[model samples]
Structures are given as structure tokens and as C-alpha cells.
Target chain A: MIIARVTGTVVATAKEPKLEGMKMLLLQPTDASGQTAKGSPVVAIDAVGAGLHDLVLYAAGSSARQTEITKDKPVDAVVMAIVDLIENQGGISYRKG
Target chain B: MIIARVTGTVVATAKEPKLEGMKMLLLQPTDASGQTAKGSPVVAIDAVGAGLHDLVLYAAGSSARQTEITKDKPVDAVVMAIVDLIENQGGISYRKG
Candidate 1:
């Protein structure tokens, strides 16, 4: 899993049949501090109802399909957990608002 | 899954039990042309006998565990297929050397 921030939402009317009604969000990978962007943004199915600017942990590849809602789906990424806080080296790096 | 080139090998004597005896290869993500480097290099279990400098396709996360040798393992990446050719816009962009 990787830490990311939900930056926006995607509205797709035409997609894989198995992905119908799934919520897709734009994720920007973040460092452990959850503030700075780390890599390219990716589209991911939202399983945890995370809102914009929310810190999240997402699974990529087949692990993204492990959720009940994404099982056997063609999706390659999923927001599996909403992060509450990030601690590194025994100190708080980020706290959700 | 993504396209990458097997750049090198990794020798590990201590690892997760399920990953014992598995060949780990260093992979560098590539563009569709398979020439330009796209992202940071990653370590992936070689499932298709990929050799050094071989252009290959690698699955990430849980899909990496779908292979027979890596099933239920802690590994997050696997080289699943060796690329024969990469065609984009109806033209060959890359071919195995």
C-alpha cells in the first residue's frame, strides 16, 4: 500500500462493465509526511468514502481488486483506508483534518 | 501491470520464508517505446525467466502473488511476461533485441 491524497474525483459514464457505479478518485502519491506529492497521480476506486484532500492508503494492482466491491474487476487501484495520522521515527508527521 | 526492463539481479540470503529460492530482478519502468525511463527502479520476482536487459511486463501488488512460485508471498511485484514487441499508433515502437 502507498500513502496518497485525494485530489479530485472522476466522473466516468463509459467504463468496464464490472466497474459500474464505482467511485473513482484522483490520487497524488505523497511521502510519509502526507504533505508533498511523491509521484504521478493515478485514478483509483474509492472504497473508504474519502473526501477531497483526505489522506489515504491505497492498494495497487491485484491487491486493489481484493476488496469486495472491486473483486474480479478490471480496476488497478483502490483507496482501501483513510489515514488518520502518520507517525515516522516516533513523531507525528501528519494529522487528518 | 506495467512495462519495464530487467536491469539487474538481486541476491538475498535472508527474506520472507515464502520468498525463499525466488529470483529477484531489478526492473526499471519504461515508456511505451521501451527506451526512456519513466519511473524509479523496482525489485520484482522473475516469473518468466527474464534475463538482464529484457523488456518485460510486470504485475504489481497482490497480482504479483498470483504466480505459482509467489503465491501468498509478501512480494509486491513480479515479472510476468517478456515483451516481443511494443506497437503504438499502428507502428512498432520496440522489439526484443
Candidate 2:
């Protein structure tokens, strides 16, 4: 799993049939502190109700397909959890607002 | 899936019991040209007979567990194919030496 922030949403009219009616969001990988960018941005299926600017944990690859909604889908990334808080080295690094 | 180069090997005397007898290799992600570093290095199970310095394609997350040898294993990455050549825009970008 990777920590990322929901930056935006994607509206695709023509996509894999399995992905029909699924919500896709743009994710920007974030560091442990959830304050800085860690890697490139990726598009992921929304399993959790993640809103814009929300910190989330997403699973990549086939694990992304393990969810009930994404099962057997051609998607490669999925938002599995909405992060509430992050603690680093015994101190709070980020708290959802 | 991602393209990477087999950089080295990992030797662990004690690891997850399910990972017993598995060969772990260090992989460095590469660009489509197979000549530039793309991302951080990762450790992946060797599903194919990959050797040091070999360009390969690897599956991440649960997809890594789809192989016959890695099925149901506690692994997140697997080298699934050894690249022979990489063609970019109708041109050969990389060829095995």
C-alpha cells in the first residue's frame, strides 16, 4: 500500500467495461508526513469515499482488484482506506481536518 | 507492471516462513528506453530465471502472487519476464547484449 492525497477526479466516458460506473480519482503520492510529494501521480479507483485533498491509502497492482467493487476489474490502483491521522516517530505528523 | 533491471540479490537467513526457498533480487526501475533510472529500487521474488543486470518486467502487489511458484505467498513483487528488446516509436531502444 502507498500513502497519497486525492488531488482531483477523472471522468472517462469510454473505458474498460468492467470499470463502468466506477469513480476514478487522481492520486499524488505523499511522504510519511503526508506533507510533501513522494512520487508521480496515478489514477486510482475509489473504493472508499475519498474527497478532494483527503489523505488516503491505496493498493496497487492486482491487490487493487481484490476489493468487492474492483474484483476482477482491469484497474491497477484502488483507494482502500481514508487516512484519519498519521504518527511518525511517536509524534503526530498529520491529522485530517 | 514495471520495467526494471536486476541489480543484485538479497540473502536473508530469517524471513517469512512462507517465503522459504524463494530467491529475492534487487530491482531498479528503468524508463521505457531501458537506459535511465525511473524510480526507487525494490526487492522482488524471481519467478523466471533472471540473472544480474538483466532487464526484466515485474508485477507488483497481488499480481505477483499469480505465478505458479509464488501463489499464495507473502510477496508483493515478482520478476515475471526477462526483456529481450525494447522498441520505442518504431525504433529499437534497447537490445540484449
**What stretches of model 2 exceed 4 Å from their correct place?**
B1-60, B63-97
C-alpha DockQ for predicted model 2 = 0.06
Worst 10 residues of 1 chain B by lDDT: B83-92
Scanning candidate 1 chain A in windows of ten residues, the lowest lDDT window is A10-19
Q: How does chain A of every candidate compare to the true chain A by TM-score?
A: 0.96, 0.96
lDDT of 1 by residue, A39-63 (tens): 6655678998998888999988767
Proportion of native contacts kept per candidate: 0.08, 0.08
Estimated TM-score for each candidate: 0.54, 0.54
List, residue by residue over A7-95, the lDDT tens digit for candidate 2: 99999898889889999999998865568887799999987678899877666777666667887899888776666665443456667
